[model samples]
Target: MPKKRILHGRIVLKDDIISGYLEVENGKITGISLAKPAISTETEFFDYGSQYIFPGFIDAHVHSFSNPDEGFEATSIGAAVGGVTTFVDMPYDRPHPIDNAAQFNQKAAKIAGHSVVDIALWGTIPKVDGVSEIPGLVKAGAAAFKMSTFETDPFRFPKISDVDIYNSLALLKHSKIITAFHSENNEMIVELIRRLKEADKVYPRAHMMSRPIIVETTAVQRLCEIAKWTGGKLHIVHVSAPETVDIIEAYRQQGVDVTCETCYQYLLLDVHDLERMGPRAKMNPPLREPETVSGLWQRLAAGKINYITSDHVPWPAEAKQKGDQNIFLAPSGLPGIELLVLAMFDAGVATGKLSPQVFAQLLATNVAARFGFKNKGQIVLGKDADFAIIDPSQTTTITDAGLHTRTDAITPLAGKTLAGQVTATWLRGRPIYQRGQVVAPMDYGEFVPGAEFGNQLAPGGDGLVFEA
Candidate 1:
């Protein structure tokens, strides 16, 4: 570690944009000053003229290394280039399911150094009685635990019961952690799918029919109730409906420890686009009507939605297409990791709809606070020196040709111009990306667990049980 380093220019410090100099020592920010300071020995300086330095983004949800050859190192690199310095990935569909402490530890070791930025893992508590593994996964370094409301493949997904959800929440509450759920009603969606198939309405639009907006709102209502009853912190991920946002708002008003996150696709694109893009644009909690998209943006701009993420599940285009026009057969995600920050900045912040301060809160600070990432998401003294240097006035067209994701499913934002670009990104004072190119190796990354709980369990350690 160096004795000191100074970075100066337009700095977004502590949720405010102000012209100041930032000082770092021992890989943490030590000072922010308008007055120049005397240089210490071994001090280095980096001056980003006219560029804005904001807290590096925290992608709260993503999927990587979930299966053999399914990991996206190139997409993770794209994430670095796009101003994301920390990624929290979901654990499902992996060669090893992260249900127990042992599997969580094993996955951690597998991705040990193969990251472009700091990475964290989300552990899943199967809907089955196996949820007993929750505490152990947390001890093993899972910053948060995950459960799904909808069951996809019978073998891959275990339909969580009301009892199962409560037990898992109790376990998480005992472990002093938050539980995030994919809030879609499984039975309702299955019934709708059954009807759609019987009516032979099995088109891309039928997929949306099977997962009507009501499912999300209903599940959110149930989850919030569970959170209130258990006093367990809850976060609803990839919320796709306006009514669901209203439900979250109601929960918050009632003093429920509930927060919600929405994705870029929901804000920028509408359900109609899915017709053109076919399965590529399709995802769980499918895109909604244009009015719903507008309403989601309205809430986002109002700061009702607590955080933002890519939900970036990247599969190769060939694999995503799956030999048919049926959206049901297509994989459930698109690559938005690279575009998340830039797209949000372009569509939200630049439109005067969201202030830069709110951007910081939604994309970086809130994520760090929510996930307990102590040394990240702020330029505070003793905090990690991670930042995104953006040229707010610069314009760029989003295109797959320039992206770093291994897959080639182009963003719908292509041909749509954006007002800003991520010129550089730094992870703990090291410039890992500059001018759209990665300067670091895929394995140069490190697994960043919360400072709240250090590693007490290994990749395959025994599951820890908490007293109920």
Candidate 2:
């Protein structure tokens, strides 16, 4: 609303950290100065003292509008407070699936006034390609077309056939919209499920055992080949295996137009946590062993994993309770939209798994480049004044009262102690979340579009946190 200056702190930028002041005017960053610039009395100033400010997080793979009761308002409450300013949501829903243009438009209408942060929508492959409106949805601004080799639902999420996938990729070959897949070989999973059940291995380990690394590797290997043949922009979602990263990296080295995203669950937790928490920690492409988890972290730090996301799923306690009787029956998703950035800062950044430069890349920079978010994912002039002012001086414990999921209960990550806490989140130069509360209006959020695969993306950034 007013010309403002963020002063007297270490400013984080793409390559070098400047101990300076940042200027914002009309919802955009206009300047970065090494010294306090002469200012008029009309200019408001907020000295950050010694806090670390980073670009607001962009989470790309979260489940929203997957049910009638679900919308962006409740989740964006968590997102805003938790430092996510933009999110690309999944296409599965109970009453309306985002398989066609009309359905996509209807869901967009549903979230019109409810979103509190920038929202992007994903479309899906329908059972019948003849009837599916992929081109129309793409023209209507779908971020990507999502399909799964492993079906999560019959009517809502049937597995796409290989022929269908190849045809769809061929159709999308030159299109800017990328094709994303949930890659797990369904046939192998079915057989493993049968064997695990016959042996009466009903423990949480069964979930992991049933879908071993091969399940993901095989699917990834095959999908890479299909994607190569069809020349479609391909991306794999919520990858859980180190081998999956290896496969994708190998393809990248070969110069394939492909990328893959991993989740916070795989990076922060392991099978033991799932064993203890049961279905609360249960998720597809399930969490791996301790060694595998270690390997994944190394891969991420080494820049093999393209980016990270929450894969934020919010299945109620009721369903998970039923899943407790049988891990297979347990819904596969862990709610983490509110915890992804903070928890990673706690585990990855503070522990030196990633430098601030690399951490920024993992959460926002790489994401923006991969998905073609030309406007965001960095703190720089001419971009939206979106940032998360973090208090890295103290520890914050995640608790039930601090969560903002639609369920209003704790997430799987609750009770974990994180290194830094987000004090405020600014979207378009406006403070939407502050002091552990979301203060933005329902109408503040708008839909953001993905640019072409090789769009002119914003530059990456790094920062120094001088002790106050």
Mind giving the per-residue lDDT tens digits that candidate 2 earns over 153-243?
8768888888778777777766667889999999999999999999989788889999999999999999998877656678999888888
Counting clashing residue pairs in each candidate, in order, gives 4, 4
Worst 10 residues of 2 by lDDT: 456-465
Report the C-alpha displacement of residue 389, candidate 1, in angstroms: 0.8
With a 3 Å backbone cut-off (N, CA, C), the pairs that clash in candidate 2 are: 13-461, 13-462, 14-460, 14-461
- Report the C-alpha lDDT of model 1 over 79-184, residue by residue, as the tens digit: 8978999998787755556788788787777665667888888888765676667657776788887788787644445557777777677555644467889889
After superposing candidate 1 on the true structure, give the runs of residues whose Cα lies further than 4 Å from its correct spot: 1-3, 39-41, 451-468
Model 1 residue pairs with clashes: 66-94, 102-460, 105-459, 106-459
Q: What Cα-based lDDT does every candidate model obtain?
A: 0.79, 0.80
lDDT of 1 at 107: 72
